[model samples]
Target: MAMEASMVKAVIFDKDGTLFDFTATWGPWTADLLRDLADDAAHADRLARAVGFDLSTCRFDPASPVIAGTPGDSARALEAALPGMTLDAIVRILIERSRDVVPAPAVPLAPLLSELTDRGLALAVVTNDAEGPALEQLDGHAHHFAFIAGCDSGHGAKPDPDPLLAAARALGHAAEDCIMVGDSLHDIRAAHAAGMRALGVLTGPATELPGAEAVLPDIGHLPRWLDATT
Candidate 1:
């Protein structure tokens, strides 16, 4: 059953695949990073496997830590692959690369967010990406978000509920008064754990998340879904 939009006072979005097209936004960057870190084909393959990416396809496994893991998690994976590199150094590299990425929004964001705000719903972004890059990705749209938390924001990361709960608290809404929209199981699971409604989107590799109240083609359809449900 669709959740009643009337009951939702806030909307929390997962960045990366939720707000932006995961492949379009991150595929090239991942490929480039792997190449820069590896000295040879054999080494590149090792790094790819360590991060759960397939070099041949340049696609990440749905279970890949890179898909939903925090920068520290990714650094750990990279550290395993490159024994000489320290975790902090790996983290710095990832953060630097991330800031340079140009996000490809799943839909035009400003107008859509405006519509939601006009409806009196508070908005936020809770992402596993580092806070710096997440903010850079939002750019002009950053002002629309009432709260923005990243892995480094000290709220912890999803599929833990700390960040989601923090976002709700920041917005002055109870967990049940918020909806979390994302394109991964981590996002859905976090919402469930946080006592918020979960709405999944297919802009990423995830297609059939088990606990999503609705699986959408993309966030572009969210307004209509909200209207119909409310």
Candidate 2:
């Protein structure tokens, strides 16, 4: 059953596919990174396969670890194709390159976030991306979030309840008083493990994520859902 919006004191969002359009934001970057790392067409293909990316379409597979995995996970996949690169070096490269990729917001973030804030709901971001890049994507809208956590924030990544629980603690809300909004099974699973209500968005490839209280097209629809439920 869907939790009542009146009962929700805070909302924790996932960065990549939840707040931003995943393919529009990351597809070009992935294509460029793969090309930069590979020595030739064959090597590029190998790297794409390793990371579950489709070179022809430059889009990630729905099941790709890169969809919800950490930068370290992406580095590991790249390492399989670029054996000469150290893991730390690969991670650094990915992070540095990510800093330059312009993010495509799933909606007009500032207005939507402001509307939620006006409703007296605290907001936060919990992402598999590093804190720096996550903040970079948030940019002008960073103030909307009361808390922002990344995989490297030391609370551990999704599928573990630490980050979600930490967000609730920071927001001064109980787990049950917060709603976790994301676009992957990892996010829903983590929210469930943390005892928060899970809401899924289709800004990513996911269509039917398990354990979600409700699924909507994107964050743009969240305000209406909240109003209707209340």
Candidate 3:
């Protein structure tokens, strides 16, 4: 059930699987990028040698519940795979390539976001992605958010309290006064670590998610949950 608005000052969200269909949004881009990489003899060999997976045989396999991790740690994972490459360079490539991967706005997540703003609730995004793609996705939904921050934006990522805590601070609210909404257990854990409540949505594969205050079907039902809470 949704908690009262009086009990919640703001809402923190995770991007990707939570807001939009992850596969529909990022899968194509990943597939195309892998294809392009595989087509390059050097990069193809690197993919086989580094990741031990052939780029050509790859498909954009959708992963379960999206969560967050430490910014530097997460970045390092991507960077470590591409030795000697600057983080900035890698992030730029990912962001540029991701442009071809469009979000499924048909999910009506944008309207829900606008509704949250209209309800006078503060909003922010704390994603696990690098700052570049994070901002690009947010700006793509510019009509929705009042403030958006990413794990790479400096505070931290999910599964740690830093990101949620920073977002609460930015919204001028206490952690207890904010609610974290996402599609993963990592998000739920993060909210708990941050001293906030969590609402998980089943928009993504549910098996990978952790516990939450409530688990609903998707963001579209969030309004109803909010109504129940209020």
Candidate 4:
């Protein structure tokens, strides 16, 4: 059974798609990366297919492994496209280049995060992104989170409860007292697996996902949902 939103004391957020507008932040970067690495238009298509990116639209496919998969997973998917490079080489390049991409926040982060913090909710970030790049992307706003963990940060990635459980403990809250807010099913799975409530946002490609407890248009609508659900 779901508890009232007012009872929640901490929030665990997914970085991409949830906090940052997924396509707006990643689409152009992926397109540029695909072009930079590919041999030609045909090669670009192949590369795009490998990562589940659509070059013509510059948007990621909903089923794209890159959307929720780790950077290492993305590198392995790309192995067949690049002949001479090893997976480790590709992963290094991806991580190095990733550090250069600035995130486009879904809403003005300062106010939204301030609102949450002001409500006495401890905040944390859990992302499938590598810890280094994930921290870099948060930039000035990293201060908002009490904890931030990525796939490389010791605990296992999402769809596994380890990181979520750790984040809740780090925030000094039980899983049941926290909410996992994100834009992917991976977030939902991890949240549920960790015994937390899951809230979804539509900042990514999907209009609606099946497993979310509630689906909002974006994180901006969270206060309203909290109000109504309370």
Give the local distance difference test score of model 3.
0.66
List ranges where model 4 is wrong by over 4 Å: 1-6
lDDT tens digits, residue span 1-230, model 2: 34434388899999999999999999999998899889999999999999989888978899888999999998987887788989999999998899999899999898999999999999999999999888988999999999999999989999798999999999999999999999999999899888899999999867778778889999999999887764
Clashes of each: 0, 0, 2, 0
TM-score of each: 0.95, 0.96, 0.76, 0.96
Which of the predicted structures, 3 or 4, would earn the higher TM-score when compared with the native? Answer: 4
Which model is ahead, 3 or 4, in terms of lDDT?
A: 4
Kindly report which residue pairs in candidate 3 clash with one another. Answer: 2-229, 185-210
lDDT of 3 by residue, 1-230 (tens): 23333477788878876786654565456546545645367765554444223345432222312223333442344565566568776556655675555666426766787888888888888777666766666666755655577666778677888978988888899888998888776788888888888898766545445558777777788778888885
Output the better candidate (1/4) by TM-score: 4
- Pairs with backbone N, CA or C atoms under 3 Å apart (clashes), candidate 1: none
Model 1 / residue 21 / CA error / Å: 0.7
Q: Mind giving the per-residue lDDT tens digits that candidate 1 earns over 1-230?
A: 34434487899999989899998888888888999899999999999999888878878888888888888899998898888889999999999889988899999998999999999999999999999899989999999999999999999999999999999999999998999999898998899888899999998877678889989999989999888876
Error of 3 at 133 (Å): 2.5
TM-score of 3: 0.76
Candidate 3 residue 94 C-alpha distance from true site, Å: 2.4
